[model samples]
Target: MEFQQLASFVEVARLLNFSKAADKLHITQSTMSARIQKLEQELGVPLFIRLGKSIRLSKYGETLLPYALQSIQAMQKGMKKIEEQKSDQTRRLTISAANPFAGIFLPPILAALHTLVPEISIQVLRNTGYSDEMYKMVMDSQIHLAFINNPHEPGVYSEESAVCLIPLYEDDFVLVARPNHPLTGRDRVSTADIKPYPLLFMGQKTSISKHMLRYFEQQQMKQQDKLEINSIPGIKEMLKQTDMVSMFPRLIVRGDLENRDLVEIPMRQPAPPLVTYLACQHDEIEPHLLKIIQESLARTITELGHPCRLFAERLA
Candidate 1:
């Protein structure tokens, strides 16, 4: 079968949606369907089971997924190598990141990348999308890497998967308020300290919100007296002006903390961890380049004085 057909199959399976896969590949939905049907016919098995508006991979599709990814990756690498030979002057690296991480964490990582590969050109896009969407983009080679906060169960995809999700660090979610707020600069503040103030919350779309709700529940606190704000900067600004406090990944508020603009309320030990991962298509990037990027991330995390430990090291 042609590489295009296999590529189409992989994208559809990865996204679990025909229209999105088609949009990603810059093809019409009909064209996408034709490619998948052609591939399935050639294989003599239906790759996907269609149930009304929903679709899922069949057993055969699951078996073919990894191999299809490898084939497309190999072909793409071969093409890229040849193209690099013809135009060796510069190389481009593209990355996507969700909102707050994009602003708070990427600058240092990008700086490190620049230092490591001075001649490379870089493009950073704001993902602000679901982790599944970012996963599809990375799989399709739309972006070379992604910084994502995934709420999926850990260990579902480890080093063995075609995609490598190297976790940079995990930060405990903490409550924060403005500098002069009664809770500011305190080593720790209890849930009782938090109850009297109006609370702000992230949208439920994010894992952070789920953790926050659970934590609030555990503390026997009610979040009904809260404002829902999805934007990180918006939350930060609101905290500065009002007596409201909110939960956040400590890494995102590092600057505010250092500037004395915010403070974390003391919570009991062993808070819920918000893990940030560096995801890449393992087969798409050269091993050595991946190593350099990984090392840069680790070093940057340390330099920034974050408490996150590398996931691979933990496994070892």
Candidate 2:
């Protein structure tokens, strides 16, 4: 059982698709299959069951999943330590974030990090998907930390699963309408009333809205039309011109909230809470990273301020 075989097996299981695993590992599909088959033969159990072209982990594979993930992570850390010694000059700390949180707080965080930790540098990856993908990057040692949305359910390779989650702050989803909208004055707007406007929605592929979309569909309110934009700013822009209402992160529009540029229409049903988090892997905890993580979380409290204070606190 070579480290390469275990690594390939883990990757295949994580994605549940051989082609994606192969693409990620920079290997051909045939090579990826051979490695998984070799690992399976050695273990005397089939790791994956093919359904048409897609793959799912079998019961035996499920039992092995956790250990396979651990083994690969451990080996990667060992290799990273050796590489860290060779570099000697710069300390590498990587952070991945989905679009909403990243765009809002990133500049200040980056500026603060550079000023305080001049000896270290940061690599930031913009991810619009679920927190699970960023968690895998930490497990693979590609990133030491991530500024992410907390997962609703526990994850297999989530850094938050093992290390810690210092939730910086939380925010609620609210409808954004232009300054003069009649609905904003009301104490609560009905889902039925929201149906009348041109609805602008963020894509499900983004961080938190994917989870929120299901709840939205359940209400069964029909909008005149659907405009699927990718960012909070884009949604805000659309609302400015037309009577399009959007469900969005409040943190994205505080300036508009204060000056009455965009009035927040409070909802009948409460919005789902989104906690911005600083997640780190347990075993690879380094001194500078811990310091930076602490500093960043503190800023999320102080700088990002009350837009987050509205929800709840889960400090790690």
Candidate 1 TM-score versus the reference:
0.60
Lowest lDDT block of 10, candidate 1: 307-316
Model 2, span 252-305: residue lDDT tens: 777778878788888888667666766676655465555665566566657646
Worst 10-residue stretch by lDDT in candidate 2? 307-316
lDDT of 1: 0.78
Q: Each model's C-alpha lDDT? A: 0.78, 0.73
**lDDT at residue 234 of model 1 (Cα atoms):** 93
Per-residue CA lDDT of model 1 for 1-316, tens digit only, reads 9999999999999899999999999999999999999999999999999999989999999999999998997898879878986777787788888645676567876887788778878898776545656766776678888887754635544455567776766777777888788877667677777788988877865656766777788778765688889778898999999999888878878889889898767765435777777777764456555566667667777787877656653221
lDDT of model 1, residue 51 = 99
User: How far is each candidate from the true structure, as Cα RMSD in Å?
Assistant: 10.1, 10.1
Give me the candidate number with maximum lDDT. Answer: 1
Candidate 1: residue pairs that collide: 188-266, 189-266
